[model samples]
Target: MTVTAESALAGVQRIIATYAQNIDAGNTDVVADLFTEDGVAEIEGQDTFEGRETIRKVYGQFSPQTPQLHLVGNTVLTSEPGEEVTATSNLVFFARGEEGWGIQLVGTYEDTAVLVDGEWKFRRRVTKFL
Candidate 1:
């Protein structure tokens, strides 16, 4: 069956939502599973995580004391038939510090997504701070 644009858009949205939820919950295993086996995640001016294992390790660095909330918005997506989908969106990072909840960073995420075993997975995501 061919994938429709609407369905692809929804799938990508779900992928983004799941990523944020898992990251906020500190479930690195699940977060990493959202990506392709060799997916790449690049954080501007920081380290780049390559592959699922590395992604899991990087996310594992987050602890209860350093909890974060990711807010995603203004998503723009483009699809190429049923093969791939690309998306760009605004991202706001909030954290609970000694004081209170506050904005930690504001950035943008450019993602490349593909279907893997009939599931949408992130092939690459580049995060840049603004």
Candidate 2:
């Protein structure tokens, strides 16, 4: 299949969306697979996780007691088609707890993604809380 710039951009967007969906649904188990074998995840104020196994384990720790939702938007991508792309997006985290539903966090995601075996996967994803 030919990869046009538009198609590559769309694929990268899908990867970002999928990550948010999986996290909000507490499906961290599959989240690691969205990344490269040696991909890195760095969440501000937390330990940096590298490699799929380590990333998986770190995400496993986020078993939220209440249902959560992640809203990701305003993605800006840089880089040529079929090459590693860097993207930045805003994040708004919501959750329902004893206090009722509310916004829990506001952040931004800075990501570097690459096409691997015909699929886009994250090479590095950084979360900065604000």
lDDT of 1 by residue, 1-130 (tens): 6888788888888899999988898888988999999999998898889999999888788644577799998887854647698988899999988898999899999999999888999999999999
- Model 2: per-residue Cα lDDT over 1-130, one tens digit each: 5666788778878999998899878788779999999999999998689999999998988967789998999887766666677888999999998888899899999999988888999999999999
Residue-pair clashes per prediction, in order, are 0, 0
lDDT (C-alpha) at residue 6 in model 1: 83
C-alpha root-mean-square deviation, each candidate:
1.5, 1.5
| C-alpha TM-scores of all predictions | 0.91, 0.92
Report lDDT (CA) for all predictions.
0.87, 0.88
Model 1, TM vs. native: 0.91
Task: Return the clash pairs for model 1, or none.
Answer: none
TM-score of 2: 0.92
- Displacement of residue 76 (Cα, Å) in model 2 is 1.1
lDDT of 1: 0.87
